[model samples]
Target: MKSLTNEVLHYTLFVMILETIEQYYTWALIAILLLNFSQRKIPNSQKKRFATIYLAALLLIFEVGVVTILTRGWPQKLAFLDLAICAALFYFFREKAWPFRFHCVNCNEKLDMNHIIGHDDNLCQKCYYEAHPEEAAKEEEKNKKLEPEQSSETLGLQDIPDTVSEIDWDIWEPREVCVITYLFENDQVLLIDKKRGLGTGLVNAPGGHIELDETAKEAAIREFKEETELDITDPIMAGRLDFQFKDSLSERAYVFFAHTYRGTPKETEEARPFWCPVSEIPYEKMWEDDQYWLPLALEGKKFEGRFIFDDQKMLDKSITVEEEDNE
Candidate 1:
């Protein structure tokens, strides 16, 4: 009789222990779900993906717990429900919840697992550097310090004559460095009838000489605003022009192209702004050299050209279309 009583007592104790463990498991699941939800609020893509994965795992655990409670045993055929749940989650959340990605979002380059799971952007190293150019610039500057210093060659040395053939372009420097920016919209490009500048009475893009402590791109934006009273953005370098004139005026011009600008083009003292069809650019009214390289620029090609001009006439010219890098 005493053994029978002891058996009952042990059975009751076992049931109580099981109940306590079940309660703890329930609380743990809730805590994990709460943590997953909180992590969803984070802006980091990797953390959000992790949270999604955690939520999926918690759902599976909950399924297993329900099956165990109902059957009083480990899942058997009910294990297939876990697989179904996985499929459903994948189907529904492939873009939003998947923790692993195989390629960069920007350039579509193959990404390793470290970038997949650890980085917020999931971009490959090259794409990452391209996106964060400041960091890349810093690294480039660091590397340049380790390399040999290059000689400083002045452009259009004062003694050099006004003949293009006589100039050694590799060592040539300009007496004045300038920039020109062309803004495009739809199928029309902005052109200016120069009112008071170097190309006065001629049609050209808004541009001017680079000022002290100014970068070529900065000069392009500033000159465009000053001449057209419009702010241009995302100016891309298209080509370089080296000019030698019979009057001994040697200049190097950087050409930029932009498709975005704010404010309406207003006539300024320097220019009368007007939009001309790309198919109808008044080449005859522009600089003679424009006919040669302007078409290339319109086609998004990079070029380098040298020209010798006698006043308004192009005396001699050489143009080479540069090969673009396959980024």
Candidate 2:
């Protein structure tokens, strides 16, 4: 009888210890989650202090729980719950999951898992330091520099606002020289399916980066032949376009308007040629800026323009047009 009584008491004691441990774990999880939530809502000025306080509290709870487990003994049945609490703390306190795929805020660089610095701010390590130079005090911080990776994520053109002035264009450098050739036949225009290079899979005019010692016009004609297997002589210079991608890679493209050309449009290794009607050009399949200046160019007007892009989405643009006779 005494043996059975002792067994019952032992079982009750075990249950009590498990309940106590679970309570501690539950409280800790709730606190951690609350701290994470508050981090977003609190002002930047208070964040440092709040974070410090949160860390101190978390450590205190951790120490107390450890001591209690050591003194009162481990509850084997509650191991799962304890492990679950650890996971919750890990996920909650480290970083919030991104609602959308990652892209840098300044330069539109895609982020790998480890380099993501924050939530929607989404600045990659390089741009983050560029924007915040004061933080780059340690050599270890420079080791976090982000390198470019090939990505094919396209932005929906419909989401872009009509006129955007949000981008700061001063930091962008004009490092690349390229050309764009628009060939017209009656009311139809020739374009190509860009097979490779920067805007792969996108519909664009037949042109490419200028080779060394090549004039912009020479590059345009060369690129035209190379991509479309057609020859266009004396193609009129229509305008100049300066494109600055969100990552600050800049290109100066000399836009050419070609009304007369030789040979039939054919596919090449670089691009696949197709003719699109002027009245129904697929702006959706082309770069976002094409919709802006292409119409004016098609009307035989010369234009000079600058376009800023966040990935494939147009962020801001400005253009000046001139009469054909004036140019």
Candidate 3:
């Protein structure tokens, strides 16, 4: 009985539906044309899309309202509810019922209303690795060997993605750089809270980006002053760490420690500088490979490192600790 009622109602609505739809179509076309005529700063694609949606919503409301007005000859039973429901549906569809967007990790392409399979980094046949089989083979072999053969324990960290959020894997570009300055005092290595993007809420060395129009040493001094709020009088550059992470959004860090400085360390939004015993640190909360290479720096030793992380966020990573070529 319910099915019969639905079928009869559907046929009745279907006949009048075209006329109802036409009314809405007219309103939509006019609205979008007017929007284009206005010429706003909004991007062309966004402008057209927003205009279409706005028109569609108006169409729905007008169609339902007119249908009730025509059939009942005026507002009557269920007319208000029908109009309200149409408006509510338009709101819901516009705000919440949109399709999920898939982004290409390598190319940063966003696709709307489509599932792009095999488009991501190595998930499909047309992936970059497939185009370069030799490189892909080598990569797989190296990845297999990266893990320790003897024990389940791995030599380097495996949280690749989070560790290398700053690098462009397909292309090398140094957008942002950092300098980690460690102060050796009374058998304690000073560690500071990051107070910035990656490890903002986490503990890290007191350092920051090497800005333009400033020498690296000068940048280091400025960063130390800004973060630690301690003015270093004689911060002779000991060495540097070139942390290379394999990611699109991750950055290579140039870490430098100073043995000599002036003023007392204080707390700031960037970091609260304090001395930690060289033997103990909250390694779990730091850059995944901090402990492996930081010790060399703390021992008054100079070295550069090449660390790779899969993701652009977090410190989980794999590291190749080596001495710097320049040093």
Scored by TM-score, the top model is 1
Query: How good is model 2 by TM-score?
Result: 0.47
Q: Rank the candidates by TM-score, best first.
A: 1, 2, 3
Cα lDDT of model 1 by residue, 58-168, tens digit: 555655654474457543334456547666766676666555578888778888755665567777888776454334334443443453131112223454455567666
lDDT of 2 at 95: 38
Candidates ranked by lDDT: 1, 2, 3
Lowest lDDT 10-residue stretch of candidate 3: 114-123
lDDT of each: 0.73, 0.66, 0.55
Candidate 3 per-residue C-alpha lDDT over 76-142 given as tens digits, one digit per residue, 9 for 90 to 100: 4345566587667766765432322365444445643222311223122234443333233344335
Report the error of model 3 at residue 287, Å: 1.3
Cα TM-score of candidate 1: 0.52
| Clash list (residue pairs), candidate 2 | 107-246, 107-247
lDDT of 2 by residue, 128-244 (tens): 543332232222223322311211112234432334354333432345667889898998889999999988989999998776555666777899999999999887777778776
Stretches of candidate 3 exceeding 4 Å from the true structure = 1-171, 236-247, 310-327
TM-scores of all models? Answer: 0.52, 0.47, 0.42
Q: What is the lDDT of residue 96 in candidate 3?
A: 32
